[model samples]
Target: MEKKHTIAITVEDQPGVFTRIAGLFARRSFNIDTITVGKSEKQGISKMIITVIGDDRDLERVEKQINKLIDTIKVTEMPKKSAFIAELCIIKVAVQDKKIRDDIFSYAKIYDAKIIGMTDKTLTMYLVGESENIESYIRLMVPFGINEISRTGVTAISKDW
Candidate 1:
């Protein structure tokens, strides 16, 4: 069965780290849904969070291959029940009138989306939470006028295993 997997990797902060990791996935023919890299708590190290969809066997193989990479300090596969997943998204919607703008505000309030910017005709909002929530919020905004949408895909941390 295919399902989503959350992977966290601690790696040396050096050039081509991401390229090599991405290359590995490509060579293995794995499809990545999202990958986010940021400075880790430990200096000189970077943490990468990757989300992929695969069967148990394929995921296991990928994890083993990732661990063999020299730059990789650690590779952790997060259990669905033990992971806290989130994504950050910024959406811009066009609102040409007061009623439409107010309606957008109502929706934002319900979703806990913050209005980060606004023009007479456009509203820019920032939302951070589960990918499902963000995606659903986007869907609700679609009928109004989705001008632009950018997302920092699934970044997750595991609860103590």
Candidate 2:
């Protein structure tokens, strides 16, 4: 069965690690849904949180290829039962009148979104939260005329410690 898998990896702070991983995925025809990489708690180390939708075999192949990379220090699938995950999104939508802008503002407040930019006909909002909230916001803003959107794929940490 194809399902979404969240894999977290700790790797050395070395160049080409991302390229190598991305190349591996491309070679294997694995479609990455989201990938978030950043400096880990320990200096000189980095952590990557990847989300992919694939079958068990496909996921196994991806995991093996990533582990074989020289820069990869540790790799593990985030346990679904005890993981806290979130995504960041920025959306710009057209707002032609005060009533429409006010409606969007109300929705933004409900979603804890911040108005980052505005023009005579548009509003840009920044929202950091679970994917569900972001999706909901997008759905709500569609009626107001979504002009653009960018999303930072899922970043996660295990709650189990």
State which candidate has the highest TM-score: 1
> What tens-digit string does per-residue lDDT give for candidate 1 at 94-145?
9999999999999999999999999998999999999889989999999999
The superposed Cα distance between candidate 2 and the true structure at residue 33, in angstroms, equals 1.0
lDDT tens digits, residues 1-161, model 2? 99999999999988888888878888989989999899999999999999998999988998998999989998889757789888999999998999998998898898999999999999998999888789988998888888999999989988955
Off by over 4 Å in 1: none
Residue ranges of candidate 2 with Cα displaced over 4 Å:
none
The positional error of residue 42 in candidate 2, measured at the CA in angstroms, is 1.1
lDDT of 2: 0.90
Cα lDDT for residue 91, candidate 2: 96
Clashing pairs in 2: none
**Which stretch of 10 consecutive residues in model 1 shows the poorest summed lDDT?**
152-161
TM-score of each: 0.96, 0.93
